[model samples]
Target: MSSLCLLALNHSAQADEAPLTLPTGTISAPALDTQDISLQTPTSAGSRLGLSALETPASTESLSGERIRQRGDRSVQDAVSRSTGISRTGTPGDGGTSLSARGFTGQGSVMQLYDGNRLYSGMGTVTFPVDTWSVERLDVLRGPASVLYGEGATGAVVNVIPKKPFTGEIENHLRLGYGSYDSQQQALDSGGSLNDTLSYRLSLNRLRSNGWIDRGDSTSDFISAALRWQATDDLAFTLAHDYGDQQPMNYFGTPLVNGRFHEGLRDKNYNIGNDKQHYNDQWTRLTSEWQLSDSVSASNELYYLKAQRRWQNAENYNWDTAGQQLLRSGNFAIKHQQEQVGDRQTFTFKHSLFGLDSQTLTGVDYNRIRFQLNSNSPFNDALPDGQPLDLQHPDKGRFDSASAYRAQFQSTTKQMSVFAENRTQLSERWSLVTGIRRDYVQVDRDDLVDGSQSDKTLTGNNWKAGLVFALTPDTSFYGQYATSTDGVGGLISLSPSQQQYDLARARQSEIGLKQVFWDQRGEWTLAAYHIVKKKLLTDDPGNPTLKQQVGQQSSRGLEASLELQLPHAWQLQANAAIVKAQYDDFEEQVDNQFVSRSGNRPVDVPRRTANLWLNKAVTDKLRAGAGVRYVDARYADLANRNELPSYTVVDAVLSWKALRNTTFGLQLNNLFDRQYAQSQYNEGQQWILGEPRSFFVTADYTF
Candidate 1:
């Protein structure tokens, strides 16, 4: 979504000079992005009525590919976590980006989309740990998005858009870099026209590194290609495919020293030496667009996805100070193979009912997925080698190779939804938008633990209504109410009890103001929201063995963001968020007794977070940037007894242009080298440490 270029043209007329002629592929004058900090008008993550960000009546933002490359962010995590109101879990180089937003986390709270399509994965993990080099844009929509994306979005939704093809002369971009911990990076992008009506584009990326901790080495590869055919002036078709593979380090976690982190234990890896994780993913899609008329358009998108995942490691590690050794347990291994196919059809047209300008959008979507799981559930023992694990020095390949994987569960899910929306411009400054959707879902599960089969079905109807009023050419105020739900049948396997209950649902009301001031050089947005969720499952009062659907939760918060394209080629950006997430009414079993947790704050959700970044152009060809991020303390358990201290980190970057079309970049991360715990798990016995100071030098060339 981000790139930069500057174009200028001068013309002189003396009888036209015999109709001047230039290069074969050059025409008109150059009009491009003159600066790296300027924001682009987003086409997605909004009302779909072609409204600008100030008129969408929602909180939405986008980061472009050029911005990502300028900052030297290699992975999705590196690019996403720095955005306002966003946090992530998992260690570095783990091949996964688990994100949190609006004080919510996990599969039922957030949704991920690839090029405007859903992946429909709910296995507690995503196999595709994308590389930023292949991305064209990443869009974010905060709060509920089921109105446009179907079910399962409560906190937010992220959309990753890849590069497409264009009809022009061949173009190429290459990058090579070296960094801390013996890391290496290589990336390539090329695209051009094959004929008058055919065009193609390709992207490739690879990263390898010996990480900061012992046995922490990782490798990743990604490749994508697309073909576009301009069949006619009114119709076009696009076909694209992408493949990825990863062998990320299996550094589960470091052992906690006396319930706290110790400097001496920062570089330790307690897991068995043979531990590792790997995965492969593939995706293919086809799209068709037709300009039916000047006022009407239609489109269709179809896609198929395949993935295979594997994990093997001593997932749980504990420190035994008395014995002077580290004890490893919870030996785990599992495999998964999943496939999904889906199709979407949309139509946009103009309509009039009450003598006003009205726009209408209608769409239908359908998807199906088959998931299978295999595991060694009853792990024999952590010490399968029958030898005590030495704390200071240990041998490699101490794994249990005799274990076999057996089918644990199998599931098949199907969903279909239809949606329609209309926007009516009643006056020059006032507009109203309304939308509604209906979704039907079905789940079929086979329990391998017992010889049994179960089927579940659920239906949901959601709606949205909003109004926008413009006070000036660049200022607007808006308010909206929206509804969403969690899949009733669940995205993965469903139990017999889940088939008898309804799906949990939520609704939110929000108001906000958006303005672009300082002669269109600065933009600001602010919003406040209150949300309530109902029909969550909890233990029944009369029957201890049964469950009831009477649980509820609520979250109230405020968000603010500001960006300035200041004078002298200097830019500044900042954002902050504060929230209170509490259980409205719930009860759980504790020590053989059911207790109330009606006012407890949810675990893993922080109350405050903020970010600030500044960049400047020192001269015609030299630039520098710096940023800082602060994350407040977080409770690791529901009881609020285990707390992880807060921490702040800093980063900086410098770039110099040495040639006409080449640049050298040096990036420094965690400049202060402060140590902090990203998170704690396994009853506070394991800790994931944040990375230390690191730097990289990159050479980029364009042709």
Candidate 2:
């Protein structure tokens, strides 16, 4: 009983399976599989099946769901700007929307996850914004994964997998879109299967845009759901949920030579007259899974999120004896509230010992977070003869202001891990895979403003070892070593007595190569890594200096990726990243530097990056795609003498399947409207222009 009536009696016994006819030797096939039939597909077991740009031993990238619905990407930073060692910093008024893997920038050491839990606000420092149609796949795990996730991955780990529900029948989809400074979007998806152990899925999304500069505007909405249950034949159970909302539009900073790239003086009335900024966000999640038997299985998850923001600016005066030109106004308010509750329990086991082939994973996790921040400012200087100014009468009219600020913080994190994995075949050509993991972490932090409060605590231990080798059967080679830790933040901007800096450690080493050719339609990967970070938390200058932490730094890297599936329905992919970061000793602000020798290349890092996509399937109801992206020069501060010039962008897509579960799509983004500047300061400038070439025409149906 219950569990949806035993999943409707296992979906009416699988709809009473009928139609069957097969005689003549009763089909005994697969004898021509002499060459091992490409190791029997399914990615030769090890259940980590490709995608994420053809997953290798490490360094990953993926954006599928039909290439994110043919590239009309609306958020999640437009699918992480099409990968390649990602970079997007301090979006939304100087401290939100940060991601900088490899050279590690914001959110400390990059780590954001969903579906596998951990979604920010555990006092690991802030950075949260996700609502890309509830993402259905986007895993980019490169470098440190903190031994099964814990601490801020010293520069990598972003998983957003969501979208599950399939068994038999019932499927639906709907999408609508519009473009250019008056954008609009709508999406909906559904799933079925209510018997034989049940199945379900639901998704909804909405987005609106009116931006191209000048107080850029935006709106977002989302909802997601999933469920699955099976009571026997080895057992099963699952549940999931997510919700979202956002309102963005607050492009600040102007001055950089009057904000280039004309668009009616970047939205007329110039002179910083019409200034207004806003923010509102919400999030939620819950999950559960179990199959406790026949080798064992278990999982559990829960999450919650909230946010708020507001700002305004306007002030100027000239009057020149009433000749006109005077407008003054000011108001600023920011209130952020966040709460998080976490849980993760995992247990897995498999068989075969002496003959090798084994698997064992054990986990325990607990997290608690509470946050609050409030700020306010109001200013007015009266005129119109209502009288207010006259503070020794140096100018003529009104002047009055008020201010208020508040802060509260709390955090608790606990994690324990133990894992074991092994696979040994050593004969039929040879096979060997090994794994080990050990982790333990505990952290606590509490900081409440004025009322005088401060507390901090930390403990850590991490380790990981890996090895995989398979010569034939599609190739394989792997090597890994890991260790990670990072924490300590009280709103970083430096100088608040450098916030008692401490806690930072990282050590990583990787070697990889994996390949699957022809039969599987082509795939290639290559990786090389070297990382060393110890107590590295720089920026300290006498008397607390607003919190600072430092103790050495080192990073070395090389990555390569390629994907090809040509011969009719063509497609090609590419990725390349290189890093060499320094400063492993010596400190005297710039006088005793041990490295960094002013060779800046770690701030919004970019040494070289590339992307190319081409797809074609002319007939069978049209299909076309084109793409190009490149980056090289970057460094807009960190004392690299300002530089951010190196840009290339192009994109195109057209898809049609006229009928049979219908589909029609058209998209063109940044098709040659380039003009870059993704960050800058010294008054203001943060442009990465070229969003004008947008066109969307989508129609999808499945049932």
Candidate 3:
């Protein structure tokens, strides 16, 4: 064992003054076990012990609905920003947010699940909107989870669990808010049980704002409803539907020397445009539990998800040649549409074999996705004479006249996976968890633009093993190793005639410690991990402007987090991470030097990051909180020459419960009005001014 691992075990032993004890009965019955509740830990359905976050062998984080509401968070982005080893990469044209965990960006690298159903598998667009009103809790599982989820889970998995039906009286909450820059928001949530077996919940939200930038406006609308039916004590059915539409400002790249900060907005004469984005998603699930005998039981879950999205935008640029400045506009438009429909089923059987205790879990999942894209553009050049043209019919000057080209690409992907996991207690203080998974993938692409067709198929096998040792009643230490794979197709080629690339493989190993102190009111965790990805995909350096994927990269890192519930109704939370990601054993076309020898940092990845938050209750009905975030400087490209400056941002909030069932809250984002860029590709003329110190005041009434 490594010295670091020994240190972790030693610490665990020191924290737990009491000896570990095992329960006598089966682990499934929760009423029989006693343990402290820590939001950072995972609860075992069988162990009955409500394990504190410090007791779980793996790295996990939880955001309770109450905590979310207190933060005045409007979206998942707002909630995830506080977690460790997490970041958001804004999408182009559309204001869609994609999550990055550890050192890997979105795609299959990070798994997104809604109610146990895989939501992002083969999904064309990387962004999804989840209604906060319907969320019961958000669980984050860090590190590789491919053994249970099957390929594409190299970094972590985020599970959004929805609220369940209540058996008692009906509940309702309505909120309205108005803020800076003419921003307005309204939301409503209501839920009730219809009968002994049926219950439902509905949520609605709307927001509009005349943004800080010129001609930059945003409008959003969302609606979601859920129904739960418990036909029997062991059988349950759930159905859900969600829809949303958004129109927000879109900005492209600008010259560095542009003295004026346009905030990514185009000048009136630039004739640039923004985008209109739309989304709709729905799902249904059925779960059944059966008790065959005293020591044996069975459970199964079936689920399906359907999602679709569309996006439509025009950009402007200035070209200077030979001391002559020429203004040009690119009237680019793309009709991108995608649909994902899939089903997943899992079954688990619990029993004791011989003198050993174990439960075998088996599952199969299948998913299909249809994606299509149509793109066209027209270019117009301005005259050197600086003549004002007609608004409806602009003149095509000395440069190339209006040129139009369109292409239609369609693709379909199907994936099926089978997995099994078993947990066994080797001794009173030691336990082992082992699992294996196999996945089959098939893809077909059709080029409507050229009548060309192509197909590809791939198969992958992944597994995981971990050992957990309970050093004391309140502390534990664990070490694990896992492997995962990601299919490479979307970024391979724009033309359907090209052959699909081989799957990329990622292997990760981690050791960590979890400990609880102060009667479970405080919890802390530290983990060290190394990940090596083979045939990893990245852009070609020689042709930076082209959209293509090259292979071979790796990343290694360490993460630490602490959550404390202090005296006097105060809470403090902090997370810090350091990562080093780079290309491995690969040579770029620009320079024949191997990437490993060059030692260039991965693009868009920061080496160090940290976040701290403090909250206090001023009175029985009043509360206040403050937070700050820091990100280290990072290289914009693999060469490591262009560096993005490091920055820190601060935020604060206050809330008052004026009445028994009424509350008022105020929030200040970007309290320092810091100007920073989230990613290297961000095109705004200036650093994406972090929301410009906006303020919002809201009133909420609950029944």
Tens digit per residue, CA lDDT, model 3, 424-537: 566788866667778887778887767988877778898777778878767778888878886553421224423445667888888888777788788788888888877754
Q: For residues 607-669, could you state the per-residue lDDT of candidate 1 as single tens digits?
A: 888888899999989999998888888777666777777889898999999898999999998
Residue 359 in model 3: lDDT? 51
lDDT of 2 by residue, 1-703 (tens): 0221232244344344431211212111111111121222322112221212222345555564446556666656556656666666555443345676677766657776665666554223343444665566666677776666666777887666667766666667787777677877788877767876777778887888877765477676777777666555444455666665555555432223232333333332222334444555455555554545554566566555554444443322122224322232233345555565666666654443333334444557665555555544223323432222211122322222355534444334344455443333445544444334455544444555435444434455665555556576677777767778766543212122333555578888888777787878776777788888777555445533332455566778787767787887777777777777755552335553433323344556676667777888889899888888776666755556556666778888888899988888888887876655554433223343335566767777766
Q: Cα RMSD (Å) between model 1 and the true structure?
A: 8.3
Who wins the TM-score comparison?
1
Clashes of each: 7, 24, 3
TM-score rank, highest first? 1, 3, 2
Task: Output the TM-score of candidate 1.
Answer: 0.91
| Residue-level lDDT for 667 in candidate 2 | 86
Clashing residue pairs found in predicted model 3: 27-46, 41-53, 536-552
TM-score of each: 0.91, 0.29, 0.83
Top candidate (lDDT)? 1
lDDT of 2: 0.55
lDDT, candidates in the order shown = 0.76, 0.55, 0.62
